[model samples]
Target: MNGTIHNRDKFLNQIASRLNRPRISSKIQKPKWKYQPQHEVYKDATQDELLAVLEEHCKKIHTDIFTTDLQGLPAVVNDVVANCGGGPVVTWKDERFSEWGLDSVMKKEWPSQQIDVFEWDHTLGEENIDKAENANVGITISEITLAESGTVVLFSDKDKGRTVSFLPKASIMLIPKSTLVPRMTQAAVKMREVYQKTGHVASCINFITGPSNSADIELNLVVGVHGPIKATYIVVNDL
Candidate 1:
């Protein structure tokens, strides 16, 4: 009878506690990086295979290309855009982009005339986002990464707003091949340290593997339903 009464008291206490639970949530800052379950370092993969893997994982074929060096930018962009039927490519204003000789590539290539290239300025306001989404391709250069999960990090200060990377149907990210890291943990540590020293949290740190995708409906996988349909990265070493 004593044991039964003890159990009854414990249940009553739990019920009372639940009834008087606090209304406000704590303001604790969680870890900056979200750990993806399948986050593992892909090894011994060729560039072609890497591209193939990204495409396979995202379930969408992308003609968009990413390159870090200001030099190979033209070739990669031309190759990817031409493959995608030479549609308009929207890019932000940057000296590196100009150094890539994008103008020459545009003028010399037969497809350039068919494609419209727009340079974005901050003055465009929110409406530019809609224009980027409607365009055939969106291209931007990345800072660099250290080649573990094939992750690319974007800082919001680059003027290529976070939306520029995510909102488009196809995103082309160019990173210096040297930026690849071997693990997600290393990336997280670096990010944390940076925040500690700077005292300013990175406005955005987007880790885009390929394209945005989901498989939630009756286990039926779908691609490009919610976000971009495709993503491509050109690990440029020449820059």
Candidate 2:
């Protein structure tokens, strides 16, 4: 049912013929770099130490950060949702919501407060995009947390649409403590491991750091122009 037809092979052949080369790919060998400082920074930091780095970076990025345990996550989520102007909230249909007791909050607490909840249902098609567009807040669980840049990685799939995080005015990302990595270097290695072992990974992986902001106008900083203006990161300590 895909409407766009790709003449990729023909295009590659044209270039290959012009260059007098075979249209064949060879195995790529790892480059020997003179220096790899990427692996050297925060090389021996523990989870707590990494958390400290994440916190420091979060401050600079103008993101609110909090830490809690499994038992306290529900409360934290409630507080954050309310702070961010309790929804019309859109979220991924992730099982972690139920596992982490957030499902109850969405179903019960928010309803009692007259807040609307919209979960991305794959069957609904483009309706999911509309929901995200109308929602005040969007919530998601971070698959990987990077301390170096204070970033949260969201792996997009059918149930986790890109618009869920992109279209909302405010966003909240939940992080399990164990998912924290020292930096993108470690995060990329984990992703490569997934691809090597499974032969595939998520189609779109997003690395979000705080709210969307730009200083393009007269060097004046403005937030929420392209995406959410408010961003929150809640790290579950004992998850």
Candidate 3:
């Protein structure tokens, strides 16, 4: 920590000396908004209302959504995988898969059907990334869901490789309905809460709305230019 601060100060001091000004080491204060408009959208909305907002936004982003309860979650996952043309699937090695009661689905169920499944293993190094890149679909659990933009926030870990979501042809996000928020405002609050509790936060926090869309070439819209060609969100109501 001391070395990091020293290096930062040295870099800043060089710039200050070049500009003929004293180095400012104090932290900047965040601006306080008078109206606080960011917190107002769907402030009192129920979970169902948030889901409605997410459903509408998904259409704009060309993503599909499926709602199911805990008991039906396994079926939903299976159907989504099938719809994405069966896998070669890559997923995060997260305990939440079992915690949310889908352990059998990931292990026994899929394997029995002859669908290849790969879990991101840090021990395997870059081999995990290669599997994800070659897979038909990547499955991940959403840390937070932003309803206003149909976005899923992911905090990357060693077991949760960043490539799993972006490298696959299609990405599957398993979102628990209770994780839904009205917009980015609440999501930001949640992230701050995570940081406060852990004393640190993930360096790679992703806010993915849908598949990659680009028009850089000749003003024509194209999908899958920079990421997955298809994206699906499976919202578990009782998870």
Tell me the lDDT of candidate 3.
0.92
Candidate 1 Cα RMSD after full superposition onto the native fold (Å): 10.6
lDDT tens per residue, model 2, 80-119: 9889878899999998889888877899888888899988
lDDT value for model 2: 0.91
Stretch of 10 with least lDDT, candidate 2: 1-10
TM-score of every model versus the real structure? 0.64, 0.89, 0.90
Off by over 4 Å in 3: 1-30
Rank ordering of all candidates by TM-score, starting from the highest: 3, 2, 1
Which candidate order results from sorting by lDDT in descending order?
3, 2, 1
The global C-alpha lDDT for each of the candidates, from Candidate 1 onward, is 0.63, 0.91, 0.92
Worst 10 residues of 1 by lDDT: 54-63
Which candidate gets the maximum lDDT versus the true structure? 3
Looking at candidate 2, what is the lDDT of residue 140?
Answer: 89
In terms of TM-score, the best-performing candidate is 3
Q: Kindly state the number of residue pairs that clash in model 3.
A: 0
Tens digit of lDDT per residue, candidate 3, span 43-95? 99999999999999999999999999888888889889999999999999998
